[model samples]
Target: MAASVTRVFVSHLAGLPVFDPGGDQVGRVRDLVAMLRVGRRPPRLLGMVVEVLSRRRIFLPMTRVTGIESGQIVTTGVLNVRRFEQRPTERLVLGELLDRRVQLVDSEEGATVLDVSIRRLPARRDWEIDKVFVRRGRGGALRRKGETLTVEWSAVTGFSLEEDSQSAESLVATFERLRPVDVANALHHLSPKRRAEVAAALDDDRLADVLEELPEDDQVEILGKLKEERAADVLEAMDPDDAADLLSELPEEDKERLLALMRPDEAADVRRLLSYEERTAGGLMTTEPIVLRPDATIADALARVRQQDLSPALAAQVYVCRPPEETPTGRYLGTIHFQRLLRDPPFTLVGSMVDSDLPPLAPDTPLRAVTSYLAAYNMVAAPVVDESGSLLGAVTVDDVLDHLLPDDWRETDFEESEHG
Candidate 1:
C-alpha cells in the first residue's frame, strides 16, 4: 500500500462529499459502482454514483476522481449531469455488496457479510475490495460460535454481479434484520423501479418505518407507486405525526384522496394534525401514545410500554390522565416516566409515580418552546393537551429534530472519515 493511499471501509465512502479541483462541492457519493471479472482478484471500481444538487443521480467515472481522503473526495473538476444508468456489468458496493451471505470454500455453513474493505490499486487509479468482514455461528452452539471474522475476498464464494433468485432472497432476508434508517439508506441507493419493488415486498409496518426514515421526496415517490389502498394502509401504519408530515407535503388533491382512503379514526387524527402550523407541537406529535388512567397500576403501565410497535421515544414515558384510555377523557392529570414505573412496585398506582412537576405542553405551543421544554426536563416526549385538559398527543424529540434539520439534511452525507 502506498503511504498516501488510504484503506477505507465501503461504509465510510458511501456518503463522502465529492468536490471539484476548485474546491467546489459537486455532490455526495451515494455508492461505488464496480464490475466483477474472471479472476481471483476483486472487482474493479468503475466509478461513483453521485447524488447531485438537483437530486438526480449521475455516474462519475473513476478517471474523474483525483483523490480520496477523510471527509471529501477530490475530483478532476468535471462531471456529467445526466442521470446514471447502470450497465449490466456494474454493481453497487453499498447496495449490493453489504449484508450478503457467502459460503466459505471449506465450510458448508453460510456467513453473513458485515462490511467490505476497499483500497486503491497500484498507480492510484483504481479501487477494489480487499477484505470482507463476516459473522458466523449461532449462540446456542456448544463449539466455537457467533463470531465475526475478517478474511481475504478469495476465501468466500456466492458473490456475483448477476441477480439470481437466491441472491434476491439473501438481499431481502439480510435487509430484514437492519434498522429502518439503514434499510432506507440502501433503498435510496437503488434504482427507482427496484426501490418500488423492495418497498412492496416489505410488510406494511416495516415499510412504513422505513419510509419514515427516507427523504420526503423519496417517501412521496414510493408511496405514489403503491396501490392506493395499500398506500393508505402503509400510511396508517406510520406514526400519525409522520404520516401527517408526509401528507402535508403532497398536492392538496392527492392528500385529500389518500386521506379519504385511510381508516376513519386514523384519518381524523391526521386531519387534526394537519390543522396545526408545521412548526407547532400539534404538528409534531403522534395522536396515539401510551395513555393510562392515573389509577392504573405500574404493571399496567409497564405492559403498555412493552408493546412491540411503540417507538423508543414514545415508550420512554406514559401519559397519566383521567381517561377513556384511547384518548384522555376525564381530565389532564400528570405523566409517568418509564424509569419511575420500573422502580415502583407493580401494585403501585401510576398516580403515585406521576411527575406532576413537569408541565404539560399546549397543543399550539411552538416547536422552539417544545424543544426547550424537553431539554429542560431531559424528556424524550412531552404530552400535548388541549384547552379542555384532554390529552391530544405526545410530541417526541425525534419529530422535533426532523423539523429542525435542513430540508436536504438526508442528502448531506459527509461523515468524519477515518484515516485508515
Candidate 2:
C-alpha cells in the first residue's frame, strides 16, 4: 500500500501521474484491479494498470508501489511490462463497477455508485475497498443528481445478489459472485435471447471462463451473437485448446474470420492446436502452461505457481525448457512438480532439480494413451512434445474428463441431485 495516502477515492487516483523513486514519470493510472470475494467482503486491491510513455499499458503490482499522493504515485521502480489482462475473479473499478445501480442495505433505497475509496490495512501491504460514494436518484451521475453519501461497502446490496431482472447489467452483477460453472448453469436455463444479452455484457475474460463451461450449442449461440471483433477478443482470453475447440464448432468461414481478427500470436497457438486430431494429446493441451528457463530458481517457480489465474492442474508443475519460454518452446528439458519446488531451498537451481525420469507424451498420442499416462503416473497434467523434441503444451486431467464424460453431462443438475 502507498504510505503517503492511507485512503484515496479511486476516482481521484484515476489518470494520476505515476513516478518512480528518482522523480521520473513512468506512466498514468488507467484503472485499479480488485479481486472479488465470495460474499459481501470488500474486494482486495490487486494493482493498477498504468500506461507508459510509449502507450503501452502494464501492470504495477501494489507490492511495488511506495506512495500515493494527491497528484502522483511513487513506485519502487519495479514494473512488469506485460499487458494487463483481467482474470476471472478480478474487477476493474473504473470500467465495470462505477455508475452501477445498488441498494442501501438498511434503507433499501436505490443509488448509483459514483466512487469508491480504498484503504491500506494497518501494518500490511494489502488494501481493500472500504467505502462507496453513491448518488441517490434515477439517472446516472452526470444527470439528475440527488443526495450523495459515502457509505461502508457492506451497506450496499445489489452488487452480488441474484435479483430478478432481464436487464444485462443486473444479471452480470448477480453473476459476479458465482463460479464459472455455476454461472454457466444459470445461463443454460436462461432464454437464448437473455443468455446472449448477459454474455455480451460480461467482460472478456469472465465471458471466456463461462463460455468454457457452457454446452457447445450454447457456446456457439452466444458467440455468434457477439460482434466479430469482440468474439475474437473473448477467444484470445480463453485457453488455446478450448478456443480451438470452440472455433472447430463454427463453419470454416466463420472460424477463419474470427482467427483472422485475433492477435497473430494468440491466433497462432489456436491454429497449432487445430492442426492436431481432436482426440489427441495436442488437441487437449493448453498452450499457456507455466514454462521456465533452466536457469530459474525454485523461488521463481514458486512465484509462478502462486498466480491466482492459473488452474490447479496447470499450477501443479512447471515445464523447464531451453529457451523461448512460450509454448512450442526450445528443447524440452523436464518438469518440476510443485511438491519438488516446495522441498528444495529457494536458492536451488531448477535445472539441477529437474525431474526427467518420466518420458514426456508425444503430441499425437491418442486420448486413451494420454489418460493412461496420467493415471499410471498419478499426474494431474502431462507435457506434450513434438517429434523434433520441442515442448508444445501440457494436457491436464480436467480436459481429458471433459472429453470422456457423456455429451449431456453439463446439462445435468448435479447440485440439485447432491442436495436432494
Assess candidate 1 and give its lDDT. 0.80
Residue pairs clashing in model 1 are none
Lowest-sum lDDT 10-residue window in model 1:
411-420
Over the stretch 34-68, how does candidate 1's per-residue lDDT look in tens digits?
88777557777888888775566789988787788
Q: At residue 383, give the lDDT of candidate 2.
A: 94
Cα-based lDDT at residue 119, candidate 2:
93
lDDT of each: 0.80, 0.85
Candidate 1 lands at a TM-score of: 0.65
For residues 1-39, could you state the per-residue lDDT of candidate 2 as single tens digits? 345568988877766789999999998786788987877
Model 2 sits at a Cα RMSD from the real structure of 16.1
Q: How accurate is candidate 2 locally (lDDT)?
A: 0.85
